[model samples]
Target: MTGWWCASRVPKWARAPIPRWRNWWPRGGSQGVRSSQDYVRKAGAAARMMLVNAAAARWKVPATECTVERGVITHGPSRRRLRYGEVAAEAARLQPPQDIPLRDPKDWKIAGKSMHRLDIPDKVMGRPVFGVDVALPGMLHASIAQCPVFGGKLKSVDASVAEKMRGVKKVVREGDFVAVVADSWWRADQALQKLRIEWDAGANGNVSSETIAAMLRDGLADPKLPQARKVGPNIPRPTSTTPPWSRRPARPG
Candidate 1:
């Protein structure tokens, strides 16, 4: 087994039917399952090989003669069988085999098939825990208000009304944003809505898509614009040309 495989014998106090994988690499979205499936499959194969070897040693037979299915190892000649849990302790002590061959895609029972997600049951039952569900003793919640326009600054705020609201602890103002802190998120949000705030939109107050496009076009036309990479002596620099689509003016709405 590679370092990726962290399988070990379950302690007496925490004995469970299934083996647990620990120390997962941090991943987000679908990439977690997509990127790690091969590693997971290989780790599982290595762990299975260890269990088969353990069963073989116990039955005094060659490991090759043992067959495994669903968590059971069987010896065809002697008709001996052992559950994964039965040999887990011994298997945990054995060194994992390397480069275990993956099963043929034709023999796959689960992969590339539509199967129910393990987490769906908990989610459907409203038993799943999310980040927002976490609560700590004496924890406070906050709601923030930011400028609606780009390049805007907080000019002034009259937070007297919000500060006096029930459960509102504090009304804080920073350079470009304001926030209300309270015992609960709802209280903070409600208090935040009551605050009277003024903003300075600065020079960008009247900026529009047309102005932004003009700025981009001006930047692109600058000869002094920094080059991200230098061209090699043998390489020729391509002539710059504006795309036909960008040359067209925006249509009036």
Candidate 2:
């Protein structure tokens, strides 16, 4: 049987056919899909036109004056031109999504090109702010301490000494885990290091990866094993692929 198409092979321009939602705003806003395709078509056209117009206006030139060439933008007499990067901030502020108009098909230059990311330079220079880099005044450090056993319960916790420790403000024990909030990450980590957790070992306490694998092997050996797949109305025998454990057999053949 043939395999499914890879996601990358799918055409981006060819959109999934879905029911268009109706625009109820024309006669006092309500809700529902549009009965006709005309409105949707007009809106799409208008948006494209607005973008081009907005770009031109932002650069302080007429719609016909500036042209988006390649990824860069150019304006003024043919010999003298500037990259879109130079004026993107101003152009973006001017567009404001709702206020700007898209360009007509004939007026487009940059949009037609295969688009690429605009923030590559910022990322390479490590100037972008990610979640991990976020900093706030008076913010405290926090870390999680998970239960040792997969399904175990925490009987109780004694944090009398931990609370008195330097930089440690409080110890929070909730559900099956505990967290120590402190002035700094080093202090929180140190406090957590000193914690003595009392766990009631459940079913998974002694269950290691090897033990689970043995159980799975026994299950696979059963003739009554449920069929995960039936290809072409026939049961395909499992192939013998060399597993790392199988290499060191007790009695080598």
Top candidate on TM-score is 1
Query: Tens digit of lDDT per residue, candidate 2, span 165-199?
Result: 89998898977788889988789878887787787
Runs of candidate 2 exceeding 4 Å displacement: 1-48, 53-128, 226-253
> What's model 1's lDDT at 6?
21
TM per candidate comes to: 0.59, 0.49
Per-prediction RMSD in angstroms? 10.0, 14.2
At residue 2, give the lDDT of candidate 1. 19
lDDT per model vs. reference: 0.76, 0.57
Clashing pairs in 1: none
Best by lDDT: 1
lDDT of 1 by residue, 25-115 (tens): 3556878557656766666677788889999999889999988876778898988988888998999899867668998888776667776
Distance (Å) between predicted and true CA of 60, model 2? 15
